[model samples]
Target: MGAWFTHLILQLAAILGSSLVTPTPLVRTDSGAQLERDWGQQVRLKHLYMEGNSRHLQINPDGHIDSSHAQNFYTLLEIKAVERGQVVIRGVNTDQYLCMDTEGNIFGSTTYREDDCNFNEEQLETFYNVYHSPRHKKVLSLSLEKRPYIPNRELPPLSMFLPRENELPMATYSRRSSERETNDTDPFGMRSGQQASPKLSRSSRG
Candidate 1:
């Protein structure tokens, strides 16, 4: 009985240790393939192209690719994020909307418009409110349009679907020492990096 109890205790300890050491499962696609990690944080679609005259396309991030009709116009594809932050979708001659969440629910659609540059601020605000909710939950949906002037076959590849490396809409600033060589003169007429030395000298004299 003593030996049996010792063996049971050892087994329990081993199980507990294994559980603690196990790692979380990495995110992956339906086919068990690994996706780009950086993208999961900021979802960006680089480009989307259509093969035929199809006016609409649906991207399912969790859907499987049909091997036999993989290239067909009706074929569905999953759009995964290549970066972090909120997913942004843009397209030529069309307006697009996205609905997705961290839980893997994603839906998108597009519609063509004559003035592609038009900005719908209200729609954008609503989108943000939904995506940035407290639950961090996302809905799956999209709205897009194809321009009437452009031929279906000649429509340019949708570059707006994917995020551009240079598309960040913000800027950053850096500090410069007074002694550093710069184009702009300081407002107070002190040379770059000279202010520190002058202050030090004055302090020593005092």
Candidate 2:
């Protein structure tokens, strides 16, 4: 009877230990819609101008600028570095444009268009291939004219420029975990302390 009771207690302790040691599974909702929403939220549209010509620019899904002149004049929108390349131009009007480099050199104006319309992905890619090719390094370094303009009214903040869908929550898991941790740590403000265990001294060891 004594051995059976000891074994039952040991089994219960083992089961409890295992349950305490196991980690809880992390659950995640559909991230595809979240990703799409985040991407759309980061999209920024701007108007670019060079040499008295202006065009509306949109940041494409691939993170490249879809310049209004992309289809008609691809050479003008060629970017050097794929990662850090950002389409920079003087506001919606005024001519004098250049492709800004990571090193701060603004390459000269390569193309110009009167109408600010019909720019798309296909045209941007074609232009990127032709003028930005390895063999065209010399043309990429040319200096273009520069024009400056001030906005008539204060431009809205960048956050306001983002689409509405992107404004939705993007980080649900972290938020949920944070809330859970907050609740678990001090649910009732109960004090946590260490329990004392009697220690044997050298003199008492004998």
lDDT score for candidate 1 against the true structure = 0.28
Model 2 agreement with the true structure over 9-90: per-residue lDDT tens digits: 9999999999889697887664553343222222222222322133323333222333443322222222111112212221
Candidate 1 wrong stretches, greater than 4 Å: 1-35, 38-83, 99-138, 141-206
Q: For candidate 2, what is the TM-score?
A: 0.22
Q: Which has the greatest lDDT?
A: 1
Colliding residue pairs in candidate 2: 50-95, 50-96, 51-95, 51-96, 52-95, 108-144
For residues 1-206, could you state the per-residue lDDT of candidate 1 as single tens digits? 99999999999999999988969888654331123223333322232322233223333322211112122222222223312323233321122223223342333333211111112111121122112211222222122322221112222222122212322122210122223324442221223323333322111211
In model 1, the worst 10-residue window by lDDT is: 114-123
Error of 1 at 39 (Å): 3.9
Q: Using TM-score, give the best candidate's number.
A: 2
lDDT of each: 0.28, 0.27
| TM-score of every prediction relative to native | 0.18, 0.22
